[model samples]
Target: MSDSILDRANKGILGLKPYEPGKPIEETQKELGIQNIIKLASNENPLGISPKALNVISTQKDLNRYPDGNATNFKQKVSEEEGIKTSMITVGNGSNDLIEFVSKCFLSEGDNAIYSQHGFAIYPLAIKSTGASAIKAKAKNWEHDLSLMKELIDKNTKVIFLASPNNPTGTVLESKKIEKFLEDIPSNVAVFVDQAYFEYLEEEKHKVSFNLVENYKNLIISRSFSKAHGLAALRLGYAVSSEEIAEFLNRVRQPFNTNSLALAAGIKAIEDKDHISSSIEINKSGLKKAEEAFNSLGFEYIDSYGNFISFDSQQDSDLSFDFFLKKGIILRSLKVYEMPNHLRVSIGLEEEMNAFIETLHDYKKALDAG
Candidate 1:
């Protein structure tokens, strides 16, 4: 008999746990035999896609031809919009792809990458897959502690992952703090700032300066069309960096990584300013509603700047998750992020958010009686 396949797998692959995505509304409905299920798990745009984006996708006729291998049009549009040269932009299947690309381009066996304790799950996964050490710097107040991150940086450190509105916790680091951190880091090490929820932030709080890319050759800023653009289904994201860094990332990127439909949708989505504004307005209102509901219910939650909030269930998160599922409501359990008593809910339409709040109240009442 042949040796066990596990024995032949890479060392990194052996210890890695696959990413668990939020349950789909349709899947839950089929399993529970319930209709009209509400999903506030994944942080998806509740406003749906812009009509302009839909128009572009509907006119696509060429399915057999390969996508632009270089993603020329998409890059050019983004470059003009962001005031960056086309040479400094690299398109990906999603921002997640860019994260992996950076990891592959720099990390290797014996190298180490640093990230905050409660940072995005993909950071560690991408780093570990490269057979590199994933260093978790202790977070301060559930946010990135730049000083702590600098302390963890050793000679083996090759990359650092920083998410402004960090996932799972929704903690944001101020722009000035990040600027100071960047000034102190060594030039050889690369810093990747993932800004997937950037458009959701209020105008006054748009503290991140993309122009920093021009000054720091090692800084890479990755953004996604999936969130604010309502193009998650299309899966388009891009990275902005110095020409040298972008060239390195492009060298490692697979050709035609983004499909043609996604390319077309992204082009239109970027120009749909009104739709984006509407999405942000809805999210702000929904977030306020959720905060008020959580406060009245006496549930502790993180102060969020993103489109989701991580709240303490005050009970076993798995049990809470199961309860919500049975009630036709889907929320995210934070056990994978090491917060077993915390659950995250994405901001949805007013009616959908109300449904979740009512269901949660019922769950709390039931727990109190028991």
Candidate 2:
């Protein structure tokens, strides 16, 4: 028999574009012969993992034992924290996993999914993996244009993915706007609100609709421990939805998809109130620093509510990326989201942010000279 696996693979899988992650620090260091390169590309928490999660991992002793398939205890902890029933939650390898599982369970070749132009790249990837048609709605000033999305939703629409404080653009959909959109959408179409960066929102400004599980039967709220909780390495996240929807996701998800360490880390991370607060504070400080830096550089950026800001260098982003690479700094060029002139940079610690600003100044000068 021929060993050509590509030929045997499903058509949709074959057509899928592999996700391109942010470049690793080691890889950049090796390539450029630079030391201590700063990576602000992948919206990672600069404070690192919570001390509680780290302590849990330090004491974890069951590497040989299989994780709980149902994740009952962890679900219970999440239930207590969120004031929702365990049945309303489905844990994920990462929030990205839940997005993929939801797409698999609800979408098909005949169905369509709607998303904003510069939303997270994972939504389109997930929909396409299920052989579902993805409808790209135009953004209104880098934010989700719900009106355009609403108009695009037809009888065949099965899912609509909205990224609050959207990636690449860092524009959030207002609570009233989302509530209005949810009220207008058909009952059968599932609404997945990707709140991967949810914890970074200030308490007064946080407007997540997690309780919509009771009100909007078809709504799903996806969250992650990766961002504010700083558990990115553990790959722990979860979804909150109606019991029926949760059951469908559980059916499609693999048993023991979450390992024991990740579960422990997630539980501890959730309980670490101080860590969450500090992380948010640091992000707020970083945001202010970044805004001032942008103003000093005379670069225009979208006023961001998330831990990252998307700005245009008024030159090709690819050129800007290359220029920044040589300066031992990394930023995401959003050509993948079709914003070729823009770059999205994650907020970092004060020193790191200052270093990045200094690098930007040096690069700007070099550009002028060239």
Candidate 3:
């Protein structure tokens, strides 16, 4: 037999499951020979992008120059917007980059990280890539069981990953419970609160993650521009922590991890408060419409704080997902999150939401006929 080049990978790497992204619109359309497809699979902004952001990116004159290594201007802008210090932030290409950086910085082969069952998939993936072990606490009511997480933490546990308004389940951890949990955990173990969907929440509804960051040295809050900011295509995200932690993360971070155009877009996106408000308003309306449709269909859904909702599917979610695809609509099947009978749908524009609901109704009719 010929010598194999693939045999050189680490044993753990061979068994890892590659992240399965939602099917791209172009690829799905090509495969099915259909046009006019509605995509509610990926949690992208249905309003597209801010006009001010597009204008700023189009007039870029410094394509050849390297970006600010420290992301000084971006940090300043974020600090101004969030009432947090520039020293408290570390920018990333996306939040995924920050997650990987945390995994590399804090975890070794014998170390462990705790996350909940049905949590964000990246937690386990990031932990595993560092040759560390993952401990999953069983979810309660499809949400993180903080008590179980506390029970699982040992001396070797270096980090814990929790997402408020968690993906696939659309569950939000209450602020008081999280505060209590943070107080209970030892000071050494870092706790990361992923707030990718923060903007979608109302003022009263937003989790108090950033508020607790200073009180606990081990706390980190990760935010992203991919959702309500309408900058998902630009791949901009950031984390807020103590200055010491930020300094250490910066040491491990790659130079120029974020591109110039993306930086320009993010700066412009943040400055355009009108665009941001409009996006949230649109999401609120879309959420109402989606919830109404789910009720009309007699489907139970998690009342979500984010811009997406996960609902119980009448049939196997994999089959229901296939049905949606055939109808030129796309929804996320939650089999990867261990919910085989549920599908998550991102809040889209009014017309897009109507199309998704109509397509789903058609699937039900077809099932009845059969």
> Which predicted model would earn the best lDDT?
1
Clashing pairs in 2: none
- lDDT (10s digit) by residue, model 3, range 241-357: 998888888888999999888888999999888998988988898888888988987888888888888988877899989998998888999998988889999999989988888
| Candidate 2 lDDT for residue 258 | 92
TM-score versus the correct structure, for each prediction? 0.98, 0.96, 0.96
Which of candidates 2 and 3 is the stronger one according to lDDT?
A: 2
The alpha-carbon deviation from the true structure for residue 251 of candidate 2, after best TM-score superposition, in angstroms, is: 0.3
Q: Rate residue 141 of model 2 by lDDT.
A: 87
Error of 3 at 223 (Å): 0.3
lDDT of 1 by residue, 78-172 (tens): 98898889999999998999999999999999999999887899999999999999999988878888998999999999999999788989888
In model 1, how large is the Cα lDDT of residue 333?
96
Question: How many backbone clashes are present in model 1?
Answer: 0
In candidate 2, what are the lDDT values of residues 31-123, reduced to their tens digit?
A: 999997989998899999988889998898978999998888899999998899999999999899999989999998888999999889999
Model 3: ten consecutive residues of lowest lDDT: 6-15
Q: How badly does each model clash, as a count of residue pairs?
A: 0, 0, 0
lDDT of 1 at 2: 91
